[model samples]
Target: MKTIAIYGDSISTGTHGEGGYEAMLKSSLSLERVYNFAVGSSGLTRKTPVGMLEVLDKNPVPKDAELFLIWHGSNDWYWGSGMEEFSHGVKEAVDRLRAAAPTAELVWVTPIYRFECPDGMAQAGEAYELPNKNGYTMLDYYEELEHSSKRLGFPLIDMRRLCGIHRDNANLYLEDRVHPNRAGYQRIGAVLDREIQRFCIY
Candidate 1:
């Protein structure tokens, strides 16, 4: 793709300077622009101060962007954002994206698994399946994305289920069972790159 725009939370707002996924895309493809309008602590619900709604309203998407990736939901689950709210927000966000950039193809990405790593990334955390504040698990969040995307007729990249990172191998990629280290970012980026190519959208 000549240009790309992104919308999501911390995972999507990765350490680009330190070899984040966006950096890999920019360097590998010699992209013209990679507009990552993601912020830390962002989510899909209206309650999120810097969520998708805020990003689209405040950060303008490049008109020439060939593709747009929406990687969120993890933080939504963590914030206990209403499941119904997330579902409706997904459609609203898609409509907003089309209105903003009619030619930019949209793609949805699910959230990766996370855990409470008390000792850090030296090993995989045991409590990877615990529910969040609103009593929703990470799986609940990503699955909701899949359901919403399917109903809305959009291509979705199931990063949570497809990415190789898991409870056993999380320590190798994740720095704190949540954010990915440089190596982790690279691994996830590779999967993402392959998926985008497979869809022939970028």
Candidate 2:
């Protein structure tokens, strides 16, 4: 029985009765223990010093963890964080995780597609531009995460591409255009189970 630690935002925390992807993965893999260090509305970078990295530093994961899964960046993009800050925060978080769990296999999961709604669109208006204009879209974050994963020697799971959430399938998977619904969580869990099996040969 292997121990897995999940670190991320709302997607990993889940909403209401869904229990998120972590719970689903636990059941699917039949693991002995699963630790969730995810928080709602959290991101890699923040204006103040209370972000994911800070949280992780304050409350480190168990050293017995065999796998460390990180899924972040959506809130960072929504909050207009710069790419450099995002990258730095990720590096810090990864370093902390590695130091805490030296033998753990690290995996980074990219952000998924978020649907644009009328309220958010109205807030943005016609002239409102993206926060990180250079790396605006979720895909840009995904690319950056992929690059970081390669540089840090961590395997990456491209959730955006693997989940296939788009304009057409937004209603089917997403609950509020940003977070996944129960069905969506199930789909993501299935894919993650397969990926974990392929990556870890326990």
lDDT of 1 by residue, 29-53 (tens): 6788888888887888776768898
Compared with the true structure, all predictions reach lDDT values of 0.76, 0.74
TM-score for each of the candidates: 0.88, 0.87
User: Cα miss at 55, model 1 (Å)?
Assistant: 1.3
Off by over 4 Å in 2: 48-50, 116-135
User: lDDT per residue, candidate 2, 35-123, as tens digits?
Assistant: 88887878777642356876776785789989988888776766656778777877888888898878888888888876442222334
Cα RMSD (Å) per model? 3.9, 3.4
Q: Which residue pairs collide in model 2, if any?
A: none
Provide the global lDDT of candidate 1 against the true structure: 0.76
Q: Give the TM-score of candidate 1.
A: 0.88
At residue 6, give the lDDT of candidate 1: 87
The candidate that achieves the highest lDDT relative to the unseen native structure: 1
Among all candidates shown, the one with the greatest TM-score = 1
